[model samples]
Target: MKVALLYNQKPDLPENTPKYQSDEFAEWDNPETIDAVANALRERCDVVKIDCNPAYLQQIITTLLEEKPDICFNITEGIGEPSREAQIPALLDMMRLRYTASDPATLCLALDKARTKEILSYYQIPTPHFRVIHSLSEGMVFLNEHHQFPLIVKPLHEGSSKGIFERSVVYSVEELSRQLREVIEQYKQPALVEQFLSGREFTVALIGNGETLEVLPIIELLFDHLPKDSRKIYSYEAKWLWDDPENPVEVFKCPAPISKELADEIASLCKRAFRALRCRDWARIDVRLNEHGKPFIIEINPLPGILPNPDEHSCFPLAARTAGIDFNALINRVLDEALKRYNLAI
Candidate 1:
């Protein structure tokens, strides 16, 4: 089988870029990650890499038409509006081409955390009670609400922990207002302020489609190694800047040591959220417990990160390893699942 690997390489920003601007556009696939996926696919199929930067998007379609690959192993993470993640899939669909990962609709809906929560709430899926604040006036509504504090705020349309930092958790109306202003002015997007989940946090990685969907080992995020003043949430610094591959932060514990009952409950909630969001091929659902130990969906990544290096702190790959699937095998498994979904013999 011929596989056209579609992806977005992280941009090489100029040295003088303002730190804030750099952080806003920092979510892109690392070169090593793209190479890892291609190498894995090369073991079982002819691989042709196509960078899906909008500047040369036409080249992707041209390569697909000329090379006539059987399918596209897409991992494109475009920039711009919240719908950016779905743009490449939408293009492929227009050309009647098959690709991996969720469809454009699911990608768009899931990318917008506010919309995803609304859908989850409608389906009776437990999620943090939240509100989207477009301005400081909108944030005033939170002051009167009886919801408990240590509220967490994040950009409505970002991933990879962008716009999230230790200061994202607010304990008072003043703190909430300051954070809201930062999100609106810096990210230019509404801020999603939710009642913080104070209990343990775990991320569940799933592969395959429908009844065959396989939930990999659950991975817990530990903040014990973090600085004393740092909040428990996974901040951007912890994900990208501070942690090192050679000496990774002791943050992840896979196959989380939990009771069978608790594990089953967490898994069930993930599967429900995955199906409710209409996710296909593969996805990573983040679940966190509240004070009572009940699980709630924090977010779902239809296009989960697959950082090749284990020490980079990529949760999906870590969970796959716990399930006895190595990096190469994990990549191929995803492709095989997509092939099966499209009714193509592997």
Candidate 2:
């Protein structure tokens, strides 16, 4: 089979680059992920890379049509634009092409944090009680009706711990108001003020079709490694703080020591969430343990990261490894699952 792997790698950069520009994050675009997928598919199929750009999207489609690949293994993480993240998959669907990962509907729904939470809540999946506040006045409703203090606040449509900080977890009405104003004015996105869960945070990796979706080893984020003054939360800096010696980026422990009952609860709820979102292929489910020791579904990530290095602090890869599958084997499993869904003989 010939396969084209699509990624949302950034399209271009400024020419005549200066010395400071070389280290920019955009410089580390999509090749690494593309290369990882390419390496795995090289042995089983003819693989090609298609980096996406709306300006030259026609060229990508044209080339793929020419190649006539049997399928597409999408790994695109289009930088800068969130909406474009679903563009490649939607295009693949329009062409009636089989592709790996969740469908466009799931991708778009997961991209909007507020919508994801709403779906989870509708299904009676436990999560932090949250309200979407378009302005400071709306935040006052959370204060008056919910009567919840020490809530967490952040942009309603972003992930990867961006725009989250100690202040994001507020303890007082004054603090909530200030954070609400900052999120509204600066991010220009609606604010999500949620009741804080003081217990542990976990990410559960799930694979297979909805009928038999499998939950791999659950991973825990160790809060003890965080700085004394920092809140026991994962922030953008904690995710990308290179210079901080005490960063807990390396503190992930797989198959976290939660009781078997809680583990089963989390896994069952995760599968339900995957079904609720119409998640296809595979996904990762985030959860939190409330003070009562019950696990709550925080959110679902349809396009979970799968870097090759399990030790590099990637939850999906680590879970795959714990499930007794190597990185290449895991990638192949994803391909096989997608093919099966398309009724294509492997």
Candidate 3:
């Protein structure tokens, strides 16, 4: 089997890079992660690495055409456009190639958090009420209509906690306005203002499709273990800065010490969200409970991160590990699922 590992490698920025731009590549996979995925695929197939950097789009396409691998293991969190993550998949589709994860349409839909919420709403799935604010004036109008305090603001088209900070949770109109401006102006995207849920947060990872879709162990984010002054939500700092391999923050609890009934409910809710989004192969769905203890879909990540390091606290791999699937096994399993979907022998 020949497998093309499609990925965007994080660029090494200069030390003088601006603070705001430091996390510009947060969504892109590190070389360590890229190599890990390639190595895993190499175990069972002939692996070819293809960097999906937009700067070299022509070169990338030429390489793909030349290699013509049987399948592509896409993890390219593309650049620029709002539908960036779908770029590689769209290209693969144009090439009539089979790949892992969701289709281009689903990837594009999931990237826009507001659109995902609307689709979830249409399906009668529980998600927080949110409004997409394109400008400060529009945000003010939303704030006037919805007087919900303690709302969370985020970039409508970001993942991996990009542009999310502790200050994202606004308790006052002033805070909300500031965040809305930052997300709109700095991130160059619409701001998603959502009613903040104050309860336990959990992330669920799922694999396969339809009735065969298997939910891995649920992971509960222990915000209580965060710094004293930090907010309960999983901010970018909490994910990358505060937590590291040397001194890991005791944050996630796999298999989530919850009642079987509650676990079943969360699992079922996640499955519904996955199917609604038309996710394929594998995905990670974030869920947070309301003050009343009701779980609501936070967001759906069809292309979930798979940081090989156990200390990194990546939710998807952590959940898979708890379910007895190691890093390499998990990678191959996803490929196998994709193959099965394409009716190709593994």
Candidate 4:
């Protein structure tokens, strides 16, 4: 089998870049992660690397045509635009090439938090009440009508905790306004102001498709491990800064110290979401409990991050490891699922 490993390598930011802009490449994979994925794919298949850099669009397209691999293991987060994550998948679609994970439309819809919530709501799935604030006036109007304290503000179109900080969980009108402005102005995107869920948070990883879909072990985020003064959120700082291979924070509990009933409920909820969104191959859904202990969909990541290092505390791999599927097996499993979907020999 031949596979093309498509990815966006994280670039170093220039000095003096604004704090808000520092996470521009946070969703992109680093050299270590890219190499890990390539090596894993190379273990079972002939692999070729294709950097999906927008600056070299023609070159990338030419390489894809020349290589003509049977399938692409896509992990490109893309650059700029609200539909960035969908760019590579859409290109693959145009070129009539098969790839792993969700289709372009699913990727685009998943990236837009508001739209994804709308779809979930349509399917009677529970998600926090949110308003997309395009400007300060819109946000102020929402605040006047809602007047809910402890709201979570985020960039409507970001993933991997980009544009999310500890201060994102606002407790007052003033804090909400500040975050709204920061996300709208600095991130250059509408702010998603959602009602905060104060209970425990969990991330669920699902692989395969339809009747054969398998939900990996659930992962609960232990916010108590965060700094004493910080809010309880898996913010950018918490995900990228405070937690590292060395001096790792004890922030995750796999198979989540929860009742079996609760675990089944979360698994069912994630499965419903995966089918509702028409996700193929695999995905990761984040869920958080409300004050009433009801699980609500936080966000859906059709293209979940797969950092190969066990010490990094990456949720998907951690969940897979707990299920007895090692990193290499997990990679090839996704490839097999995609191949089966395309009716191609693996």
lDDT of 2 by residue, 1-346 (tens): 8888776563355686632333323322445666887898886888887776555678998988898789999877554555645778888888888899888888888878888888888989877877888986776776566456778898886767767877898887788888988898887889887888888989989888957778899998877766788878777656655324343256788889888988888889899999999988889988888888788877788888776754457788898888898888888888888888888966
Look at candidate 3 and tell me the lDDT of residue 277: 93
Clashes of 4: 0
Per-residue CA lDDT of model 4 for 170-289, tens digit only, reads 988889889999998988889998999999999999999989999999999998877899888899888877776567668899989999999999999999999999999999999999
1 against 3, candidate with superior lDDT: 3
Question: How does model 1 fare in lDDT?
Answer: 0.88
lDDT of each: 0.88, 0.78, 0.91, 0.90
Tell me the alpha-carbon RMSD of every candidate.
Answer: 1.9, 3.4, 1.7, 2.1
Q: What is the lDDT of residue 29 in candidate 2?
A: 41
Over 4 Å off, model 4: 12-22
Better by lDDT, candidate 2 or 1: 1
Which candidate, 2 or 4, has the higher lDDT?
4
User: Would you estimate the TM-scores of all the predictions?
Assistant: 0.95, 0.90, 0.95, 0.95
Question: How well does candidate 2 match the true structure in TM-score terms?
Answer: 0.90
Task: Evaluate residue 167 in candidate 4 and report its C-alpha lDDT on the 0 to 100 scale.
Answer: 90
